[model samples]
Target: MITISVTGMTCGCCVNKVRDKVGALPGVTGVDVDLADGKVTIAGITPERTALADAVAAAGFHLAD
Candidate 1:
């Protein structure tokens, strides 16, 4: 799993948005979000960091560097 920190997630809807965005990417088999910790865990072959960031951004969230 690849773990990344994100911001602007505060509730179930936020989690769902992140999950759907990240999960839609190629090679992403799974997506798990930790609202309290602001973490997103992705399973399967890792995609490019930029692509991941873009997906997160499209969902209205920012990925912490």
Candidate 2:
């Protein structure tokens, strides 16, 4: 499992968007979004950090540092 802190996720819809986008990645098998904490946990094979960050950005959110 890889954990990423995401910003601008303020509601259920945001969570859903993140989940749907990240969860669709080739190696991703699971995704958990915490709107209250602005965290997204993903389970999958090792994924490129740049790809992950880009995906989050494309979905209209910032991948927190």
State every prediction's TM-score relative to the real structure.
Answer: 0.96, 0.93
Show pairs that collide, candidate 1. none
RMSD of 2: 0.8
Candidate 2 has which clashing residue pairs, if any? none
Candidate lDDT values, in order: 0.95, 0.87
The top-ranked prediction according to lDDT is 1
Summarize candidate 2's per-residue lDDT along 1-65 as a digit string, tens digits: 98889999878888888998888888999999988888889997747888888888878999888
Off by over 4 Å in 1: none
TM-score of model 2 (CA atoms) = 0.93
By TM-score, how accurate is candidate 1? 0.96
Stretches of candidate 2 above 4 Å error?
none
RMSD (CA, Å), each prediction: 0.6, 0.8
